[model samples]
Target chain A: MYRISYKAFKFEAKDALLYRIDPRAKLFVALYSMTISIITFDLTTLILLTIYLMIYISLLGKILRKIMRNLLVLTPLIIIIFLANYLVTFNIITSLVPAVKLITLVLSMNIFFLTTSPDDFSLTLEKLGVPLTITLAFSLSLRFIIVLSKQLNEITEAQLSRGYTLDRGGLIQRIKNFIPILVPMIVLSIKRSIDIAETLEVRGFRTDVKHTPYHDLKTTRRDVVFTLSSIVSITIFYYPLQDILSLFIPL
Target chain B: MIEFRNVWFKYDEEGDFILRNINLTIKRGEVISILGDNGSGKTTLIKHMNGLLKPTKGDVYVDGENTRDKPISELSRKVAIVFQYPEKMFFSPSVEEELKATLKNFGLEGEELNNRLEEILEEFRLVDLRDRTPFSLSGGEQRRLSIAIALSWDPDYVILDEPTTGLDGYSRRDLTKTIEKVLAKNKTVVIVTHDLEYLFEFAPRVILLSRGAIVFQGSFKELLENEDVIMRNGLESPKISMLMKVVRRDGGGCGMRYSELLSVIIERLGCSEDV
Candidate 1:
């Protein structure tokens, strides 16, 4: 099996517009966008929001490549949703709207995460009054998502090299082929977690004491303006504008 | 024999080439080592040997069959790779079951399968751990089990990637002895490693890569003599080689094992009577 590279989640250190914004502002934008996208059933509003997010992501330069790669991975799921809906409802054209909406929501989240590093994400959580232990747990989980996938990929390759064929099997047989891979992956993850815990203990990580960050997050004028505009736009779209549009446009 | 002709590779079309214009031939039963710094494409090159990766341009031939023509499963019968963290691949409840499953993939069954499994367990010194789960073994034992699983099918070519990583002094010696056993069976062995000491002692022919190209390809002695190439590639000479350089006042000969170094020192000190 080919290893899937989760390039989008990897941090980009370049100085782009999104990267330069305060992590809190970006996190707020992401949360707002996701909330607005979920509440609005209007296809036009979703399309407009998707276009806006697309334009913003396009401006991220090198990070745009990672976002595009992530979008490629989402293609199969989007296709499956569309096909399932069409099969059930027997309406191909209308069924696509939900799939497109899901894609837009994913793109909105990807835009935020692809630009923000894990360090900045934890800082955002800390700034939002999350417990230090929770913030540390969140950051460690994010880091290990990448690490565990790499371990899985290596394990898959190693098994394949040992003359283990994963392809060409019935459904049950195919899943059975993964037993060797899954068992080792779970075992390795447990081992890694123990190692991480020991390392934290050795480093004297304490939940009781207040911890200071290396890079202090300060909101600049650009961040303030972006955050305010995003909140206002999402507010207008989710409330009055959607209500007014729904009255004129049938359902 | 494995051959690469004008082979070039990149993971993405827009990405920088990882292996550029690699042309080389490894004859049957030849033991060779590939040395390179991180990101120098050592792993990428060996991945091509077993059809894990296909060249973007040109071709790779394993035993006169183009890698592109065969599936990885088919190519794997001719070449087996034991990855650095091979222990992570174990899934069988016991070591015997693990070997049995691998041999099953090669279409062995019944009495033949049991016999092959017994032989492999004996060869890797893993008979004592036959009933134990592979995950429960020590690090060194796990490594040996990994190699044993790879060799269960008896592929003509065995490639190891960074075998010495995370191995202790005794474990490293065990790995060396295992490789010696593989080589004794007249199997072609290819190793990709940063362990200069292992390479010096075991590999007679070394290919040094820098920036996706071979910079030096010769015996260890030639590599030692060309200090500029070694330094440029960010590699350190083996410890014994460095010590010999200091004592002899000039780099006369490079030694890997302790006994070789002792003999060199004795010869240098004019103690022929003892010899």
Candidate 2:
């Protein structure tokens, strides 16, 4: 119902500031954080990374609650990680370090995803010389995430009218209730994706022949600034010997 | 001309047949309006025209040529299909690009493309919104853009599935004008609509489909004369037609044309022509 108000699955980086920055730069920052978090297993390093992520969310992004809501799926896994570390590790410090690192990585991923729209990510990929086919596939999958969420609600409503109940049911019963909704949603998503792919292929998107975009995607100076800053941050964080830190690194 | 011979379709092998043994033909320069209930395979029947969905049993022919032997790009050049929901095709941002994408894909360029595009844009009155984002347009604007894009290729046959949906009175009126232009040019137009009012207003030959078969095929006027046929087939005559029947039953007047219907009202209401 709200797809239109939510821009109905269109180019909706509506926050004026968000739109000003180069899409490619935002994409670089997302990727850089992910890479930096994964390379370090030290507790101090992980904490510093988390602090940076927290500051970024609080200052630059201002999407803390929104990211938390998106990370709901990872919450249980996070709990499991904490429990597993408690039960399995000999060194409390060692176990906690990897756990913190993983959490930082997950949080960084959330920020990256939150800031960078699929259009930007694809543009970045295209610039990186990734094949057009792979970039297009990645885009469709990302587009499906937004489209399917809206569809899932409608399917559930239709199922409810048809005597399928999800209310007050135990785990098994709820699982049974989900079958009808999931079957149609996934089936329709796959069908529509293939249908759209066929439409694009017919329109000459997948072929080697060059075609102009219906909408222009200009590479702006902000994108350049974003790339330089991210590259500098990534270099500093990647090298253990380097002392490059945030000027406001809160030392 | 469009022809469907023994066309059968099922969603899957294990599923019930959605369309069965459908044999029908729509001749060139003839307007056909299809009316059916919700699950009466209205969309499924027309989706075959553009090769969006292929027949599971037999073949569909466009302009006397069998579609099974032709690629969709070739078929698309002859048969332009407007979907039930026009918003689904709105992948492009602006209206100009939306129509140009069709021409571009066909490798059309230069002054020829620009001239042809400007002509359609003016005819449809979408010239003002040529550079505006398609997604940001009103529902009516979107529907009109859908029609304009379909006409961009100038296909011999234009198929519209519920074109007036989500449109207001003025937009619908302009679209009727556009439809008349298509008719004047002798292009075959196949409209799938349950709007009996429009069917009556346009007076196209009606083809009523029920359970994947063409049950009635005749002029709209002749079909409305049979009460039993309309009732049995879950169809209703337009409000104007029903009103005309009530007036005709009272032995008042015998006016059939829309102008005649209006003049009949003028005479009955005692309005002087030169007053």
Best by lDDT: 1
Off by over 4 Å in 1: A38-41, A60-69, A75-100, A232-251, B242-275
Docking quality of model 1: it rates as: medium
B138-235 per-residue lDDT for model 2 (tens digits): 87787788788777777898888888787788878777878888888899999898777766556778888887777888887777776567777777
lDDT of 1 by residue, B1-275 (tens): 99999999998777899999999999999888899999999999999999988999989999999999998888998899988776777888999998888888789999999989889989999989999988888778888998887788888999989988888989988988898899999999998987787775573688999889988898877787787887789787666677867755644456444566667678778887466
* Candidate 2: docking tier: incorrect
TM-score of predicted structure 1? 0.88
lDDT of 1 by residue, A113-228 (tens): 87788888888889899998888899999998889878877888777777677776899999988887889898889988999999989998888988888899998899899888
| lDDT for residue B206 in candidate 2, whole number 0-100 | 81
Model 1: how far residue B111 lies from native, Å: 2.7
Worst 10 residues of 1 chain B by lDDT: B250-259
Each model's chain A TM-score: 0.82, 0.73
Every candidate's lDDT: 0.82, 0.70
B274: Cα error in model 1, Å: 11
